[model samples]
Target: MSQNHTWLEIRELAEALYCSVKSVYIYRDKNLFKAGTHYYSVGEGKLRGKHIYNLELCRKALLERTAKDSRSNETYDNKEINKLMTRKLDNKNLSYRK
Candidate 1:
């Protein structure tokens, strides 16, 4: 919402953001820096103007961001079910038929 004191350097930014600088670096490295700002490289690996953070973006990122990702690896044999069901009926049709 209000982020008058939102613009901050690395440590301050991390503190205000309630996250670690390392996490910030991790996000930055992963290109997951969803803080709604374009990074303008300061120089020699330093960055500036990264404090364009806002509550909306932070909330969205926090809500959407996952701490640990679960890779979808479940391989199911749907061909059999598809063969039996075909496109003839939906779940409701099957249930109603019962």
Candidate 2:
């Protein structure tokens, strides 16, 4: 909600993201970005009832989510993979009867 942030309509947001308007709506529906926090609805006679996106807020939220996902899915080294595989094999062998 900084003064420098540009407010965009759904179409404009989709255009900025290189996506369809429906996709933007979908993101809104999925709560990937929050309303009021990331955007707000204008209740003017001219605008009727269309939400406006605070560009910086939306971009920041998306980037933070992306960074969190990347950290959670951190790449494993060969040794770590080998150790996980060994554990899985051992568990599988233990389940079998002689």
Leading candidate by lDDT? 2
What TM-score does candidate 2 get on C-alpha atoms? 0.65
Give the range where candidate 2 is weakest over 10 consecutive residues by summed lDDT. Answer: 88-97
Clashing pairs in 1: none
Q: Work out the TM-score per prediction.
A: 0.41, 0.65
* lDDT string, candidate 1, 3-97, tens digits: 65344456765676688888767766686664446233333544543444443455355555653243344444789777867757655666443
**Model 1 weakest lDDT span, ten residues long:** 34-43
Model 1 earns a TM-score of: 0.41
Whole-model lDDT, candidate 2?
A: 0.81
Task: Tell me the deviation in Å of residue 85 in model 2.
Answer: 12
